[model samples]
Target chain A: MHLEEFAEGNSFIHKLDPRVKFLTVIPSVFAIAAMKTIAAPIAALIVCLILVILSRLDLKKLIIRLITVNVFIFFLWIFLPFSYPGEAFFQIGNLIATKEGLLHVLSITLKSNAIVLLTIVILGTSEVFSLSHALIHLKLPRKLVLLFFFFYRYITVMHDEYVKMKKAILIRCFKPKSNLHTYKTYAYLIGMLIIRSFERSQRIYNAMLCRGFKNNFPIISHFELKKIDIAFGIAMIIIFFSLIAVFENTFTQVPIWIYQKTLALVGQASRLS
Target chain B: MHISEGVLSPAVLIAGALLTAGGVAIGLKKMDYNKIPGVAVLSSTFFVASLIHIPVGPVSSHLILNGLVGILLGWMAFPSILVALFLQALLFQFGGLTTLGVNTLIMSAPAVIAFYLFSYLIKRGNNIITIVAGFLSGAVGVGLAGLFMGLSLLGTGEEFVNIVKLVIAAHIPVMLIEGLITAFCVVFLKRVKPEIVGA
Candidate 1:
């Protein structure tokens, strides 16, 4: 029910240009992903945490979101320590936890949290519609942007229809058990939803034709970059670029002479595992 | 399931982004202006449908009907899924920005594969064949997606080999459920609105 809850704020982040937010957040996320050590992601995570706190988002909602994101991480933790073969960090009755595995999972955890938080703080702080508009400004295909706009516009309508259908079925004592009946019911529900959408699109298309429909959907508004927006963009670019620089032997920048050395290291490491 | 951001190595991320861009380009090229509303609304419907949670015990799992999307839209499932995921990221934060390309590829590539593999049967075949094709499409959609997600995870290191297997194993139930649901859905569509199945 609380769509774009993070976007509805008077904070400085909310006021920043969506274009800048898009341009900066993407590279920063990739940078966080590429970090080889935990320290860098921890730093990035701390920065994002501060930004989110400053943005005045509802902590309850943010906590829920973070918990959902961590579910995947939680799964990683379960099998990784016992399954990854390496120097033993600890021992259970028959289970062995590897030092390398724990470190790797920890790094993944930090980087994942940092990247998700950064994305929420930056791109998520703007209305999704505005972000679509910004995608056009960022040189994404206009057709894709228009599609995104139209998709978001109709999603709520379809959801309302879905809720109504669910209510009707619930009133009919439709209990969703793990059975053929439940599956069939859901299939019917989806089938009905699709049929309605297809039918409604016909009317929508006809209405547009009546209103002088064209192939192109043109925007009435364009983005105007402000000084503050540019300044924030530059600051973020530097921060993220520096984060990317922290990896001394990351994939993209391995020196040619050290290539064989790194390859040898990889071979040795593989042997260890 | 959407692989969260920052989990994949850059190599996998870049590969996913490139493939997704190529798929989206083909989809856009095939799509004309008039079909925009139809594609948008259809994808929106799928987006809403994904929220339906069926009880699997004490826990419930939401639907991932990429097979249905692929059958409905064919190649256009690419852009449709891309937009849906972007909305999910923006609205629910189910996935994040960095992993957008990878997640989109994970879901939609299988969708495209399912379309090619099963759409023909669903269109031209009789009731039993249609149901069988629908089941295959649904199962293949999630099955291939689970495989692709595992491969993407493997890009991080061989350490994730166990996780990769687990990820694929975990999807078996969903695949079965999706197969059944999709089979019935296709049958229903064939009965109620035959042309809407793919026309």
Candidate 2:
């Protein structure tokens, strides 16, 4: 369903040379991941926010799309600290939770959020083709690149087929009453999907043979890097390093709720003293 | 179970990337280009498989048939899973670039082992054997992935074994279903599209 909605365009982010953006993303991801303290990620999060702004995407749509996936990951992030063991900050009722565990959970949450946000920034603005070329340039094997190319090309077709299958099942009022029944239905669906895809692959191979059967897929020939690409690359590196250098050690003020709790704790401690 | 970029240490991520690259090179060296489309189709199947969620009580879990891919594609599953994981990371944010190698290895290793061990079981027309292998392969793959993921948490400054238990426990049901599904899927392929199953 998501694949069908992917729109091709000449937007600015999409227009920037793919290599520059691709290279930029790696460092940004690395820097975001390497931050032992929260400040770097909060800053990286700000950068992601700025990129999102610059991309001119509809804010509501992007948030909805991201939140849909983040909801699942957030579940794990929220539960990890409580279930995990570490030094306790304090106790509530019978539970002994630690500030250390909370910090670890918060870091995981922030880091994952930063990565997702950066992905949205990168993919939301760039064309899939550019990314593929960047991968090829980055020295991924040719077959791997081609595999991605053809896979994306046919994924929309497979997705449509899946939708039709699901709709047909719905139309037939097919519903499984038990876990076993559901599992059977799903297994059968997977079987059918595989059979269908294999058949399509045969056709694709045949078509490739008919035109000019060669091992190598034809490479797209139109992506030449220019001055803009170089400038963007340079600018990205400078900004990323500058942020890391300036704020690498600063304490990230946790979100307002945590800050309030911490402040309250500090107040209580001072009173005790 | 894709670990995102910020989830791993730089040392581990870079080391994983290099190690995965080496594995990919070893895999590719023996592969023929003619088999590339088959790998692509299987990779696409993996992508689509992830989208198919079967509800388990209140929440639903999806099947990731990395084992099935491994059984069918052999070593090529590495690059195939790598590509699919990368795209999933980029498109759906299912995983991150930094942890791509680790995640790829996490899912692919079990599949490779499954292929070697289970390829023989496909004979004798024993559906049970096929099914059992599928189940074990899927379970083992995810189980191993969870274990390594838990181990990776050591660098994150967190408890290890408990995280392992949590991840492994959560995936148990899906692993069972994935095993059966892969088994039957293989049988079905053997019935109609035997060639695709590499029979």
Q: What is the C-alpha RMSD of each candidate to the true structure, in Å?
A: 3.9, 8.4
Model 2: per-residue Cα lDDT over B1-199, one tens digit each: 6665565677777777787887787677756777667668757877787888777767777788877877777888888888888777777677777788888877877778877877667644476776676667666666666666666666654554455576778777767767767777777777776767666
Q: Which stretches of candidate 2 lie over 4 Å from their true place?
A: A4-11, A76-88, A213-221, A249-273
Question: Which pairs, if any, clash in model 1?
Answer: none
**Best prediction by TM-score:** 1
Give the TM-score of each candidate: 0.94, 0.86
The per-model lDDT (C-alpha) reads 0.86, 0.72
Chain A TM-scores, candidates in order: 0.90, 0.79
Question: Model 2 lDDT vs. the true structure?
Answer: 0.72
Distance (Å) between predicted and true CA of A254, model 1?
2.3
